[model samples]
Target: MSTTALIYEGDWVSGTSQLDEKFIGYVESMNRSGGLKVRVTQCDREDAVGTSVEAALAKVRKLPDYTPSAPEELKDLIELSLATHDKEWFDELSARLAAPQAAAEQDEEKRYRFTPYQSRLYRIAE
Candidate 1:
């Protein structure tokens, strides 16, 4: 069988691996706090970046009312918004969002990574 490649952080880690294999390898490289893995993977890429960001926001919204303590990258994203929009409003919203997200992370059940959906488009495009 021919192998399909999944690019991780624009680097080739495991070549010719199945989707699950590639995803497991990617998750292993992540830090447990702040959902940094999601932020980095979703926000960094050209192809899946926007979709990933949308997914992240949806995940965040689904969490219970808890606070996120260690959220440097998220803070930066909020700050970026403040730079463009209203600083005070964004700051308050950021704080509120941070708390629940932090609480959500404390749970053992939070699904962290983006699940890959298979498509024929990859083959068709090629």
Candidate 2:
């Protein structure tokens, strides 16, 4: 039976090979004949991260998309982005971490409904 392809370029994946250190990396390229090149990011074997490593499609499991909500988690991701020299990802994580504080300020504004007298006092002066 033919199976649907779930992995693609740039997807984070974990290795399923019988090695001492299981690698986690993003897919760099793929071949139609069940082969792929992964840019190893996190692994015990430090020497293998030089370029890209080859693996069978069946030997890699795609990692699920995740958005970390905790400040510590977001900071960790920001550090990782910096380590990888991914400016776009660094900006994204920084923005994501800052969004909550902005939203909290907006929520406070919404909560303090102004009276007619207070509204006039707070109105823009021409």
TM-score versus the correct structure, for each prediction: 0.20, 0.58
**How many steric clashes between backbone atoms does each model show?**
6, 0
- Model 2 gets an lDDT of 0.81
Give the candidate number with the greatest TM-score. Answer: 2
Report per-prediction Cα RMSD to one decimal.
Answer: 25.6, 8.0
User: For model 2, which pairs clash?
Assistant: none
- Candidate 1 lDDT over residue span 1-126, tens digit each: 111122223221221122111111122222223231332233223454322221111122211233444567567667777788877767776877677767777663545543466333355555
- Clashing pairs for predicted structure model 1, backbone only: 66-99, 66-100, 67-99, 67-102, 68-98, 68-102
Candidate 2's error at 22, in angstroms? 1.8
The runs of at least 3 residues in candidate 1 whose Cα sits more than 4 Å from the true structure, single-residue gaps closed, are: 1-70, 86-96, 101-126
Error of 2 at 117 (Å): 15
